[model samples]
Target: MAFEDVVVGEARPYADKVVIEEYDPSWPDRYRALADQLHAVLGDTLRLVAHKGSTSVPGLAAKPIIDLVAAVTDSAAEPSYVPALEAVGYRLRVREPDWYQHRMLRKRIVDGADENAHLHVYTEGCPEIAKNLAFRDWLRAHPEDRDRYAEVKRELAKREWRYVQDYAEAKTEIIEDIIAKARAAGVEVPA
Candidate 1:
């Protein structure tokens, strides 16, 4: 099913679960190590690779997942990068061509525990890339926004959710608000 087909609160037999964790100082180091591995695998195929999400922020609470956005020449061309990524334990989980041709890869679980990392692949210049980067920066620079977002996330995390995407979509309002503020303040949007 496409992203649009995912309804909020609709339970599925097998849905991706989420786990929010306290902000950890080691997150950056973890991201660096994972990015290094990815770089070694992806080499020059990635146009841009960055750590996004609240985990990337200094004090923001997050799901303990290192959200990395990698802009590829063409995410639709999964064959170009999927094999290399899989060879190193990354498994392509979601392929949504309907949504900016986005592709999500999760690191294979070592045992029963989650891999704690997700890599989102997008075509160069995808608008979602800018929005994610902008929100991450905005939260980093504004303590008030960061704290507020953290509160909202913590509150939302407490409730039962069908799919992780539903929990994510629930944050759209606050995300849009921050993006709107960024736009008003002359922040650049991805072209």
Candidate 2:
């Protein structure tokens, strides 16, 4: 599906340069707090929650936004969880039913801190969950690829992007290459 079709609400153009910040030691704590909140809200529906993306990897420069993955019973069944999430200040931003029933909800200005986070929701057993975890674990164990990804992100951040998603899309090639290497090294990347 097209980007326009997948987004739940407004497809706001970023219209700004991406900002990549040096890794912060406190990122994991922030992720844990958010994960805790998700657990509280999601309860039995939540299957698993994980910290993914660059912020999850220590020493990796990132956009300062925490990226989290929450595996649930059924992501496409929004009525089961979306309302509860919204009640707790999360706004459903993206819903890509065509792509593993993926849903992305975002929380801005987390806990009064000038920070944001994305919660990517997918069904339990989705291969994307394993792929995300594998990517994060690979980067954590391999500094060479981690630094390479950081360099690529820094370079991409230098250019203007119409949408933040565009900036994310730009990193796909490098991400795939790294994941391929991870798979070659016995990492479990579900097909």
Candidate 3:
């Protein structure tokens, strides 16, 4: 999809039906499964891979899907990594140069028959990973904030949009606000 197609609050029918369900403690198992598949595909080129989204946060409601970040030693090494991933059914879909040289791969079953996951790949130590994890961790630690965010998600999910990313972006303001509060409160994720 084109960048223009990612307007906030515009849920693409293609990405509709996505919902944030109550937190599933088993999300970690799902991540582990994907991580194992990824590790077998990329082997040593993978520097670090971690569960870093809402699914990783305990008790924080999330879309019933796993979000993982695979950190490579260098992004220029995509040629070595991307092909292997595709062979295993994960297709590279998004590339962001301005955003920490991030790349995203969407995993689907067969010829786009089913949506499996959204995999975000980046070079080691990218700040975005930390930011994502921190927001999720902070939300998990602060139930009030988590509830507030969940309410925003519920309200947004009720709207129609062209893409789910649009729905995700709509939450950015509140997310950043929470992140700011966390920082102001001196909340930091353990290294």
Across residues 54-134, which tens digit of lDDT does each residue of candidate 2 receive? 999999999889999999998889999999988887888898878899999888883553348999999998999989998
lDDT of 3: 0.77
lDDT of 3 by residue, 1-191 (tens): 55543222332355456577998887888788889988998899898888877788787778876788888987646797899888777777777666677888877654562436778888888777787778877877888998888888888878886766677788898888898899889877332
The estimated TM-scores of all candidates read 0.87, 0.95, 0.85
Per-residue lDDT of candidate 1, residues 54-173 (tens digit): 889999889877889999899999889999988877777777777899888877465333456889899998999987898899889999989988888888887777667778889988
**Which numbered prediction scores highest in lDDT against the true structure?**
2
Model 3 CA deviation exceeding 4 Å by range: 1-15, 109-115, 188-191
Off by over 4 Å in 2: 110-115
Error of 3 at 177 (Å): 0.8
Deviation in Å, model 1, residue 149 alpha carbon: 0.5
Point out the worst 10-residue segment of candidate 2 by lDDT: 106-115
> Number of clashing pairs, model 3?
8
